[model samples]
Target: MGKKTTHKFKAEVSQLLDILVHSLYTNKEIFLRELISNASDALEKARFKTQASGETDELAPEIRVTVDADAKTLTVTDTGVGMTRDELMRNIGTIAHSGTAELAKLAEQGKESLDSLIGRFGVGFYSVYMVADEVTVTTKSMDADARPIVWTSDGRTDYKLQELDEDRPHGTEITVSLKEDLASQFTNEAHLKHVVKTHSNFINFPIYVGGERVNTIQALWREPKFQIKAEQYAEFYKFLTFDSEDPFDTLHTSVDAPVQFNALMFIPRHGNDPFGLGRENRGLDLYVRRVLIEKQNKDLLPEYLGFIKGVVDTEDLPLNISRETLQDNLLMRKISSTLVKQVLDHLAKMAKDDADRYNEFWRAHGELFKAGYMDFLNKDKFAGLVRFNSSSLDDDKGLTSLADYIARAKEDQKEIYYAYGPSREALALSPHLEVFRRKHVEVLYLFEPIDEFVMDALREYEGCALVSAEHADMAKLDKFESMEKEDKPEPLSDEQKTELDKLLARMKDVLGDAVTEVKASTRLSESPVCLANPDGNVTSSMDKIMRVMSKDTSIPKKILEINPDHALIRNMLAILEKDENDPFIDQAANQLYESALLLEGYLTDPHALVGRVQDLLTKSSSWYVASGK
Candidate 1:
């Protein structure tokens, strides 16, 4: 041992310490992850250097973590190219050159390669003091002539450095005297294992927890896409998602321009927490040069892609900057936006190139895309990636992209029409589709509630407007002429029709302003009555979402359209002619309107519906008794 010279922190370092201790980071547990990540980086660098130079006697690269529960101390040791006495003082004791500032300067100079600059910053080392009361660093550089060095700091305002005289092995060991409250975390093997697995599992070098190798999976992000085997991807998926089933799809890609990034994204076979009662999805993990920075980085991908789990490793990330408090940093924003675009493009390409695999992915996570389309309307890049089932395609029951729909549109069609309901069958049976179906116009059938909002936001695709089938003006569509030009079916004589209209006006008075209008509908073929929100004030899809969100079933008011060609309407008209005072006719008409509202997914009073059905059945029974008995 030599004389340990205690030195005060550099002015910049002392200020940085105050900020880190008081305001920089929000979560203290992040300190362990940061320190571990730094150690892993060092080990990886040493491995690479040894491979290149072939100078080291022991070429094995490994990171080992040991915990002393009784003494409340934790140590992380790595067989890496450690720092010399002078290097240790320069690297750990002072803020020599800020990594982020250097990156910015490099950007200005148009120099993009930052791979060798992984551990250049000194801030991450200080993070250990967040959880530990004292930290000791023992390091021996790869240079044979250099002496081993030991650095000590109590996380106050000063640190001490000395040259060690003991014949110690090469590499570095960091020991932390943990705070009392944080000791439990270090003592629990399970907790430490989870932290290591989450943050350092994909480190380029092996990581050992208690002398057992914990990181068995390779860092696929660092490898070439073609080099990855299927089993390797499956194992990585299992490690990332904790899923036993194989992933539906995986996108492995790297980009250098704008921002350097390496992403290995996997779409799981099933979504996270399907019932909606469990925790919200955490999105993807974020890494910087194989070190886990953010476990659940929602900013990396849109919320709709929560089903995707994988690792994104970037060497250019400013890790010292708080991701939570990141403001208008244009570089990070560009990186995030670029990543999202790349993901969307990858998905689109997959759907086009490998239809079968993309279909499987859509089956597992199509609703998430729909939800994203609605929530991230401003992200048109993602919106263009959305896919849904269309009434046009029969061979492909899976999904149809907006681009495909645009390509298949009619030559003269000005808009893309869509209808949303509970299911494909329900949408096929919808009365609103009669005119479009007859015209041979393909309508996109939306089964999810978010589809409406998606369409509303999209509004148009490739210069074509997205129009809903339920629009009142849609009834007057001239594209499809009636098959037969027979005169309109006469429901009642002119005088009688006028009298019925007057009666309906009186009924409207009784019903208050619950209806927009009562009109004879030409859109219906078999249905007696239907509701339309032509102006889309309270769209049927919106109503359904509100009901689902609120858990309420009360029906709202609507515009009722009666089909003049329907036998039920004609019979009611004749019944009123015989006796205008017949209350049964009024009840039947009201019941027909209520039934249409229900079919349209509007909220209605069930008691009123049941009472009307019971009354109608009783009337039929009485009529049968009067005629036969």
Candidate 2:
């Protein structure tokens, strides 16, 4: 040492030191992360300068974390831009901000507020004091005129600054004399290596621990998309998620407007969880300038896009002084908005260019992504991306988008109709589909319970209201008649129509409050009866979900739509004509109501329906035997 002097720390810096050590930080291991980030930033600056000057700055930049257990010390050395005596005094010996009194109040307010540190200490270098009783820095500047100097501090009230005559390399070295309580955790080589891998693994420079490199994973998101190969992306994805298979689709996005961010996202072949459900709070790794700021940050993307897995690196996010939490929600929201648009744009492009691949993406992620109907700002885009099995399709394997359905829609049709059920086959059996089938209209088959919510959220798409088939207007649907003829019974005459009116009234009376109304329906062809919601404000799917959540097992009341043209209704009418108060008529009405309930999946008790079914079967068998063939 050539010369030595002592200096007192700024008033606010002393208070902030107390907060950093005792109050704010719950995880003490991150202090090493803060130190490493500062080192990385320094190295980046040196690298930029070398590029600007078109020459080597001194040495190839690298970060080395060395742990000394016996000596109770940990040292982090970085070959980057170093500081001079004056720079050290200004940066470390005193306050990094002006107005000490004002910042002192801010620091005092944060005594228990783990929120922010008003007194920032040179890009978070002060974090070292969390595990140390004293810290020593030895450095020589890249400027040849500057001499090697040393700054030692206890981080309490003051620090010691001295000049060195020995010729040290141009870089910065920080060694911490660990505090007694934190020595075992901070000075263990394995523990320090783990911390580096968790937080600073993507640092631009190489990091070595005990002669072995620790940060080997590349920050691939920052690279140009075209420059990388598919194999490289697969390797990175596997390393990120530990999944052996490659991704179904990869979205490599670099956005410059609203908020600048580079994101490389993946849609896994099977979701991150085995269930294939994507509506989760699972988030992506959030990095600021290539350094991990928050892992699995849930707010970066909406929960509907939870199936998307990858890293997001932004260069201009405002972070709290601790860098542990986001500071500005508005900036974050802007970034989120940009991410959503880019993702939707990419998906729409995928849909247009490669439909088979897009449908494969849907099979894997549609259940999760459908919940995005709540994203109204991009509802049109989301609607365009949705895929559903339809009535016109032969099986569930065949899927269609709303755009395709609309392209083939009838000229007079004004709504996009859908029917909800557990499977494609179940929806196909819905009585609401008869008219659509007759007129050759397409009806989307919605399977998941969440599909109801999606339809409700997205009330319309491209000028067409999304209407459930159960709530279809009979008067409007009757207009579009199919030209094909059926080989069925003749139309009813005036006298039979009068007889059917009495039968309808009788059936409604027997069912009591079980049905709101029992009326004739042209919407049914083969099916004898179907249930419809009378309220019109709620669809059957929505009502069923609400009833189930409330733990109400009772069957919901609904309007019964009877196909008078069907043989069952004609026979019932004839029986009513013979005897106005017949036992068979009452039994048949009750059975019809319960059967409708069963079709709607709301029937809680089926004993009565089963007994009626057996009675009718036995009577028909007796008639067949009595008739002698």
Candidate 3:
């Protein structure tokens, strides 16, 4: 053995290592990932060197991870370019090249603290100390005449280096003698294989653990789109999600503007947590050069887009010591914003080019994606992707985008109209749709509770306000001409108008503060009555959602709009004209109020409705028999 030399780690570097081994122990398994990643990097550099020198090496680039159970040692070996004595000292023996010194200086200046520097640099090699008490690295450089060297460290203050007499393979091998308590954890073949598969499975070169190839799955996202086949994407999707079914759609994007990243995102055919169980925590796997930094990184995409799965590999992100997560939130946001925009662009394309597929996507994901209205920064793009069943569509299964709705809408339409109910069948019977139907205007049907919140969050899109149907009383729908229906009813005469005004007054007195106002509705066409939002700020849908969230079943007061042309209202007016205080008058007014509640989906109990209908039925039957029909 040649003379050995010892080098000391700076105090701050020592503290940083302590932080890595102890403070960042949320996942102790990540130490294995870091070592594998280092070996992979070394192998990549070796490949580049051989290619750059125009020399073909006999051996293909490889990484082997092995554990010695009896020895309690874990070793990671790589066929790559190795470093010399001076190079090892510069790279491993000192903190100079590793940015530890600069980070410490920054800490001294109070720009950042020593504790905060835990994951801000790439000193991943030291992570081995988390599981190992001692580490030995043996290497022979690719240089023809270079001598082999051994670098050994206890990961305390100092490390020593010695020159070896005999030559070895021109690559590096790192062996870590596991700490007694951690030996069983890493020495177990299955656990080590799992750690490798989870983190470094996508390494360009092959990775073998315990002499069996473990990382056989390629990093499909890193490949160019032209090189990828549809079958490959499908297979990759299955491997990624463990789903037997192929993805509904795959978006392979390489974004450069705002930030640079390569993302292969899969929209599943369907989600397990369709009801949003654990939805907020779902995220994409974030990778730096195909080595996973964070699994299910929630910051990459909002919970609303949690249905989207797969990997995001970006060179733009900086990893901390453990590579457990990213260093900067702003950089993450930039990537996230770019990814979201790209996804929206793809969906818009899908909507245009592949209507059938896009419709299926809407049906499967609308409940999940509609919640994205809270991302107000991308409101316009999100609006274009939002799909809703419209009044113009024959069935609830039919959907229309806000852009499409606007395209088919009357030119004078200034607001994007929407309504909420149990189903398309229920919304079709809604009195609020009367005027929209007459004017041939489309109204979005919101079936889920979340869609109400979506409309409230996104108040407008592309210069048009998102108006809920409950607030149709406030919309400017009178300007458009009504569609020609057979035998359109005449306007009420002045005398009858005076009588109807009296009826509205009587209804207010009968219903009291239960209604904000009782007025003849210009928006109502077929249905006799419907409820409206007196406080436009809180539409009926918004209020309903709020109540449900609060677990409150109590219905609040709303505006009552009546159609004078409807037979029910006309009969009520006749009863009021003949006898102002008749007991039947109060029954008629209260019945209409409850009927409006039923139409608006706020009627929890049908007992009152049942009693009213029976009373009307009894009187109609008696009248029918007395008339000798």
Task: Give the candidate number with the greatest TM-score.
Answer: 2
- Candidate 3 per-residue lDDT, tens place, 185-211, comes to 889989888888888888888889899
- The global Cα lDDT (0 to 1) of model 1 is 0.72
- The candidate maximizing lDDT is 2
For candidate 3, list the clashing residue pairs, or say none: 119-320, 119-321
How should the candidates be ordered by lDDT, best one leading? Answer: 2, 3, 1
Candidate 3 Cα errors over 4 Å, as ranges: 13-26, 56-59, 97-118, 255-260, 272-274, 278-281, 411-415, 457-465, 473-476, 484-498, 550-553, 572-577, 604-609
Q: Candidate 1 residues 326-370, lDDT tens each?
A: 232575667777767767777878877887787777777777666
Tens digit of lDDT per residue, candidate 2, span 1-629?
A: 68788888767777767766655456667678877887887788788878888886648789999988899999989988888888888777665555666566766676444445521334377767767889999988877698999999887888888899889888899999998988888877888788889888898899998778999988999898889999999999999888899988899888887788899898889754424443443688999888788887888888778888899999888565556678778988998888888788888999999999898888887877887888889888988898888887888888898888888888878899998888876776778787787787789998888888888888887888888887888787878877567656788889889988888889899999989999888678889898888888798888889988998877777898888889988998888888998898899888888898888887777888898999999999999999999
Instruction: For each candidate in the order shown, give its overall lDDT on alpha carbons.
Output: 0.72, 0.82, 0.80
Query: Runs in model 2 with CA error above 4 Å?
Result: 51-55, 98-112, 118-123, 273-281
Q: After superposition, how far is residue 123 of candidate 2 from its true place, in Å?
A: 4.9
Taking all chains together, each candidate's TM-score versus the true structure is 0.78, 0.94, 0.89
What is the number of residue pairs that collide in model 3? 2
